[model samples]
Target: MSVDLPVSSPTWVSAFLDLAAEELERGSAFWAQVTGTTLSAVRGAQHEFTTLVPTDGDDHLRIQRRDAGGSRVHLDLHVPDQAAAAAYAVELGAEVVRPEEREDGFVVLVSPGGLSFCFVGQRATTRSRPTSWPAGHRSRVDQVSIDAPGRLLAAELAFWRDLTGWRLRRTAYPEFHQLEVPSSQPLQVLLQRLDDDATEVSVHLDLTTDDVGAELERHVALGARVLASHDHWTVLADPGGLRYCVAGDPPDHDVPA
Candidate 1:
């Protein structure tokens, strides 16, 4: 099942954190400081929506207050033609949770693995300058990692490949794969097969940093708890108890094996 996707059209992907209403303020504050961005005035009839305004580029992060479940992160794909984009995603096995019609419409979809994402009409033109870390810290959220049950790995990988058209490559680690987006895109998507029997798919954000130690320290001061430390990456939980990682750059698509 294929829908015509214009080769010339650009797609912009952004990330959003959805937290319980009770944790919205704390979660919003924590993410704002971590990303060096400010929170916009809360909008939406329920006052559950806010955007993280970066100092330079377009805001790629947002905060939403949900009624249930633990905090989780999801992606937003911005394209010029909302209808076509959403139609193609449905054809790729996504279930449409909400449909859209107007130019500024929003279509919510859940992937085969049950992970949620949205397609928004029109590209975000405001490009912020690359993130500027504090005096000693050099890091930015350059990729999002999706953890899927081992049993569903193949189907999950195929769903994302069809949706984004990003080139997929195997990593040095057998359990992990990288969906390499074009250099023009701001974020990469990593798919990791879980060893446990868990059947649900979930996502976590990752930051690439030059100095993991220094960056970890900064995060600790900002109320992030260190869960574990490894040579390549450090596991951390924010004030809202959402887990994320800070790591050195991993191999890229152009890198030789």
Candidate 2:
């Protein structure tokens, strides 16, 4: 089916950040990304998952969607200083969404486009060893992907291409294009054709599911719509209309040993 998407680049634009991944703490990372919290799990999987509680008005973390793509694919970077990082991000044309604040020795920040990332005030005391994947183990975050209006594809591509100097990675599917950038994590930015111009922002937290069909049924019970799918993945919109995906394909990164 034909979909509407962007085909031109924005005339005036600035630089974007190239994010990198470090196996710091997945639960910490997950909590950071999902709820904007900087705490690690008290007792749980440390490498592949993280959790947090809500206080004040922060209860929105669990149910609320993080992005339109369902999972965040932008780089999770570690920086030496939050203030310096904020300064550099501004210099690079990223408007501040969250200012640097100390919490567990790291300051978390989300980019202008709602990409969640962190800046560290101190270095990690220890580094994680790499892991190789078996047939179906939870692996490192391969890449976070997004879907954009097809009419905005050219504009979006121009913005990112100039920023990263990376070329577009095409798939057999005609609805989207992917861009790979430099980062320890296998990240891809997806430009997808949208049916409505009313749809603006794209962000969602992705969860791995063994069966997209079954997951979609579960989500339908919870309240969401199946948006799109392919041989490897299926997209769904949460009750709030935020989009995300459950995949049948193996992840791009290997599992840590």
Candidate 3:
């Protein structure tokens, strides 16, 4: 039976930067500075969630603090009906983490490949623009890179492709696949295959800048330390202990074949 996928694909909403409470303030502050966004009033019973609001666009970034756990980044998907989306996700191999639906229509589920994300009931239509710094560079933290171990990458890639209703394209690198989402969407996902099959699936944010070298310096000045440098991207550890990257990839929206 051919399954209809168009009307069911969820919208990419926000990326959650999950850090320890102690590091939450520091991390959220640092992220706010780098992304050129302001912190929204913290919400949640424990005062654990905050939004990174931009001056001209709908929010696509958020922060979450955990009572105890290592820092990590998670994705959020917005759908017209979150409950229906959650059920569809389960039918597509996602396991429910928060089985009882919340009043807000937020549903948490772990993808078959082990990546955890939420299905949100609301929507974000205004995409954020890249910020221009006084020092002479423009950048936008507009992508979430999903790192899946070699053996699981294929399945994970397919899952994300169908879930986002994005055009899946093969990149120049055999290890990477691009989910070509609508350019109007605030964020996109890049599926990267890791070398070790035993390595767990994880995610990180990617900020694209016109001047990678300058952006690298700016990040370091903001307390991010370099982990490694590639020809087009630099991996770094954020002040909150989360890992992300700064890349010189042009915002041309093309995934090289």
Candidate 4:
């Protein structure tokens, strides 16, 4: 099987914020404002998809209206020969969830740990940059943390690392294995080993912000709630009830100010 994925690695990754129909309006607006983006015209078979168009670079975020789910995050890997990438992913233990979607060049898949993502052509070359806000604070939706059960962590890690061919590295947190994507790539990847409690895989996003305090306050004023706080990061639920984090100073800035 000759599956030719992008030769330079996938440059664009669009994280899809799947929200319940009732939350679409509020969620779309909230995400756009928070990320310094404008919502693109609605497009999809059922008018269920909208891209968050950024001001400085290619798009890397999208919102999807779902009929029933509360709120969830899935991503689309934009690679050349999407069909071949889907096939390659299947060979690496991913299960195709929507073969029918391939007619239009979209194919959904579930990872070994059961987290859902799909494939699309790698059309965007420029990466989405961090947004500048009041007080000159900069933040970008940078990473997606895949939370997996202890029993499945090993396989999950193997599947993602192998599938993306990214450098697998250890993180400060013992439970985390970060996949170091090239700076050209839109989103970073983190595999978190969870306590052997949950039976299913799940995902949440992280926005690397230079000023966490300001970001938190701004987000709260825009209809977000703090779930928990740590020295390095703060977790919150957005207006549409989707959870994410305002992760402290990005990884690139290793030294303290």
**Whole-model Cα lDDT per candidate?**
0.79, 0.41, 0.82, 0.83
What's the ranking of the predictions by TM-score, best on top? 3, 4, 1, 2
Candidates 1 and 4, the one with greater lDDT: 4
Q: Give the poorly placed runs of model 2, Cα more than 4 Å off.
A: 1-76, 81-88, 101-142, 150-155, 158-168, 181-183, 186-188, 206-232, 238-241, 252-257
Of candidates 2 and 1, the better by lDDT: 1
lDDT of 4 by residue, 1-257 (tens): 65443332455777899989999899999998888899999988889999999897788889999998688999888777777787888888889998635446788899998899988874887765678886878888888999999999999988888788777999898989999886776778888998879887988989888788888889999999999998788999998788998888763342112
CA deviation > 4 Å runs, candidate 1: 1-10, 101-104, 125-127, 250-257
| Candidate 3 lDDT tens digits, 134-186 | 88888988888999998888788878777766778989888888887766677
In terms of lDDT, the poorest run of 10 residues in model 4 is 248-257
Give the per-residue lDDT of model 1 (tens digit) for 139-208.
6776889889998889899988777777689998898899877665667789999899876788889987
Runs off by more than 4 Å, candidate 4: 1-9, 100-103, 250-257
- TM-score of each model, in listed order: 0.89, 0.47, 0.92, 0.91
Clashing pairs in 1: 56-128, 57-127, 57-128, 58-128
